[model samples]
Target: MNIHFIAIGGSAMHNLALALHKKGYTITGSDDAIFEPSKSRLEAKGLLPKEFGWFTNNINSNLDAIILGMHAKPDNPELLKAQELGLKIYSYPEFLYEQSKDKTRVVIGGSHGKTTITSMILHVMNYHEIAVDYMVGAQLEGFDTMVHLTSENEFIVLEGDEYLSSPIDRRPKFHLYKPNIALLSGIAWDHINVFPTYENYVKQFSIFVNSLTNGGIMVYNEEDAEVKKVVEQATSSIKKYPYSTPNFKIVDGITFINTSFGEMPLEFFGKHNLQNMVGAKWICLHMGVGEDEFYEAISSFKGASKRLEKIAENNNSVVFKDFAHSPSKVKATTTAVKNQYSNRKLLACLELHTYSSLNTEFLKEYKGALNSADTAVVFYSPKALEIKRLEKISEEQIKNAFEQDDLIVYTNATEFKEFLFTQNFENSVLLLMSSGNYGGLDFTKFKDLM
Candidate 1:
């Protein structure tokens, strides 16, 4: 197979390029820019493009297919050339379907927890010596690449993203993978730039349920009211298996799940993760993993990267960094930490980085999101506002939106760092939540300063 990728430096796209390269496919790719990790990994595999930007000369009739990344615009030069050449162009999701059509596909989908759920399934599968191809959003400890493909694996686990597949392909990425087994965690209105309306955002999930293969199994989070409604309305011929948060207890800041075998301790804590485990259990059961076996494997499961990850910890103080910028995620992550350590004071700091988080209209949805924290601090860079071309937001507006009278807001990264430095860490858990870095604050260096 011969494939050329547009915007191949993307997290997912680069992984797919490496997977195909390993499979003996002649893979070539181009991107307007490439960042660390992706650049290093692609270069290591000899898959990095000779130059950065797209070139029409890179497109040729000899290419078997063109896999387009979501980052590539419709007006991309290489894409235009591919179209002019009358070449078969497939969005990354569409190409994934082409490769895994013969295999049993298990796709985990939702606004959040999709990565965690997919990671849990992959961890259990790997522990049980189940050889399967997979793709997960976040990088797991054992996985070399976010994507893996093979001719022999009978099953493939895919983390289904609800974002648009490609510029040319207007469908959500998850809609491309018509799964034999599917899991929908829950729905929170996201990708407002694309979906535009709440009703339209929810309708995508409906389309996904209808797209499942005949007699497929749908594992859903019954605890989520919105998810319950969505699953109940799913008129497909699929078998529905609903799950909620499993019975668990927190002992000395550690979480454990109660099972028939006994209590199994886990490295992760939180209701969302507990719910993720239940959903994963159902999916694994359908894949022939026994209840006892699933418990045994999941005991060693840590967590997905950036999903409430412990960055720095000591006997008295612990610092966790989470990729949580959305209203629902902020609330869940903040609530989880507070519940886990009820005896300790929670100092939760969130960076308003994502477009949704920074948007003045969407700010009200975050009301009481950080109420669980003893001291809640919100930070957003004014330069970020200028970069996004958004109107300047006032500190009063943010405070009013969150409806927290005691909320402290910062528009300068230095001031935020100084505030963090002066805080007392003893008997406190510091939670830093953001989808972006706190304005170039090296977390590693910050740990030493603590």
Candidate 2:
């Protein structure tokens, strides 16, 4: 198979390129710029273009398929060339569906927890020596590539993202999966630039639910009222399975799960994580994994990268970094850390990096989201707002939006870093949340201080 990629330097796109390259496909890709990790990884596989930027010559008639990334503009030169040649063009998700049409697709979808839940399922499957193809959003501990595809694997686990599939593909990426077994972690409005309103954002998930294959099973979070309502109204042909926070206890700041095999300790924690585990458990069960086997395998599951990932820790303090920019994710993550380490003072700092999180209209949803923290700090960059073409937001607006009169808000990364460095770390936990690097601040430098 001959596969070409546009905007190949993207996290997901590069992974997909490597996966296909490893699968014996003749792969080629182009990007205006390639950053570290993606650049080195692609170079190692001989998939990186010799020069940055799209070239019309790269899009040829011999290519069997062209996979487009979200980073590519609609008028991208290579994309236009491919269209002009009447070649087959597929969004990343669409191409994934084309490859796994015969396999039992297990798509994990929701506003949050999808990556963690998908990672758990993949971890258990790998532990049990069960072979399955997958396309996860985040990098897993043992997986070399985030995407895997093969003719032999009977199932494919997909981290179903609700965002637009491509620059030209308006459909939500999850809608293309048509899963035989699906899981919805929860629904929280996001992607304000695309969906605009909360109701419109939610409607995307409803459409995703309706797209499931006939007789498919949907494992959803019962604790989320919005999730419950969506699952209940889903097509009757699909089987509904609802899950909530499982029985678990935290002892000495460590979380343990209550299972039939006895109390199994975990390397991860938080009520939200526990809830995600329950949904993953149900999905595993449906995939023919027994409760005992699931528990045994999940015991060693550390966690997905950047989802409540422990960057550094010591006797006096611990530091975590999470990909939590949305209002609901911010709240859940803040609450989780506070609940997990009730004995310690919590210093939660969040970056308003995403378009939704930085939007003037969407900022209101974040009211009291960080109230659990002993000290809450919100950071945003005026440069970021300009790049995203969003309305200007002030520190006062952010402070007022959170409804925390005493909330500390910073528009400058230097100021934020200075504030962080001056904080007293004794007997405290620092939770740093954002989808982007906090204005290129080096997180590793602060790791030792923890």
Candidate 3:
């Protein structure tokens, strides 16, 4: 197959390009801009565009398909040319569905825990030497690329993102994956820019559930009320399996799962993670993996890239970085860290990076989200708000929104770094929470102080 990509420098787009390239497809792509990791990886694979910018000339009759990324605008020249040629054009998700139409699709979807749950399932499958094509949001330890596609693999595991597929395609990416087996971890309203209202945000998931293949299985988190409601109202033809936090205990700062086989010590900790594990187990079971085998494989599962990832640690303190920008994720992550190390003083630092988190109207949802931490610090860059063309928010606004009297807000990265450096690390845990880089603050330089 000959494929061309529009705005292919995206995280998922680059990975898809690389995956197709490996599949012996002639692949070419163009983008306005490409960032690190994506740029380097694409360059290494010889898939990177020689020059960055779209060329209408690149789209012609020879191309079999054009996969569009969200980065492309509606008037993107290449996209217009492709349309004029009457060539097959698909949003990334649509193309994925086309490729996996013959395979059993297992899609893991939720506002949170989707990546971790998908990673766990992939980890167990790899441990069992189960070869299956897969596409996960985050990079795993052993996986070379986030996306894998093959003609032989009977099943394909997909991390179902609810974000818009492409600028031209208004449907949520998850909606395109008509899964044979699906999992919804939980629901928390997000992507305020696209959905606008909480009700509208939730409607997307409902649509996703409705899109599942007939007689498909849905594994959901019973503890999540919204998810429970959605699953209950789902068509009776779809089999529903619910899971929650399994029996587990934290002993001496280590989390152990109480399974029928025995107490299994895990490299990863936290209640959210425990819940994710249960969901993963149910999915694995559907794929013919026994409880004992799943547990054994999961025992060594460290974690995904940035979900409570331990960046640096010592006897006195441990520093973690998480991709937690949403209010619900912040609360859950903070509570999880504190619960794991009860003896330590938790210093939770969060960056208000996303459009939802930075919006004044959406700020109120963050009330008491960081209450689990002994000291809560919220950081937001004014430049970020300006770039988003949002009304300026004061430090007071953030403090009031969180409804935590003890919360400290900062707009300056250097000052935040200094404040962090002054804190005594003894018996304390630092949790850096943000989807952004916290204004490019170097956490490594301050690790020694901690």
Alpha carbon lDDT of each predicted model = 0.92, 0.92, 0.93
Q: Model 1 — TM-score against the truth?
A: 0.98
Q: List where candidate 2 sits over 4 angstroms from the true fold.
A: none
What is the lDDT, from 0 to 100, of the residue 206 in candidate 2?
A: 90
The segments of candidate 3 whose C-alpha lies over 4 angstroms from its true place after superposition are none
Candidate 1: Cα lDDT at 117: 95
Compared with the true structure, what per-residue lDDT tens digits does model 3 show for residues 1-450? 999999989999999999999999999999999998999999998988999899998999999999999999999999999999999999999999999999999999999999999999999999999999999989999999999999989999999999998988899999999999999999999999999998998989988888889999999999999999988898647999999988889899999878877788999988888999999999999999999999999999999998899988888789999999899999999999999999999999999998999899999999999999999999999999999999999988998999998889999988988898888888889999999987888868755665
TM-score of each: 0.98, 0.98, 0.98
Of 1 and 3, the candidate ahead on lDDT is 3
Expressed as tens digits, the lDDT of each residue in 1-450 for candidate 1 is 889999999999999999999989999999999998999999999998898998999999999999999899889999999999999999999999999999999999999999999999999999989999999999999889999999999999999999988999899999999999999998998888788788999999999988899999999998888888988898989899999887789999999888887787898889998999899999999999999999999989889999999888878888999998888989999999999999999999999998778888878889999999999999999999898888889999999999999999999899898999888889889999998988977788547745
Residue range 95-162, candidate 2, lDDT tens digits? 99998999999999999999999999999999999999999988888889999999889999999999
Worst 10 residues of 2 by lDDT: 441-450
* Candidate 1 lDDT trough over 10 residues, lowest sum: 441-450
The superposed Cα distance between candidate 1 and the true structure at residue 178, in angstroms, equals 0.4
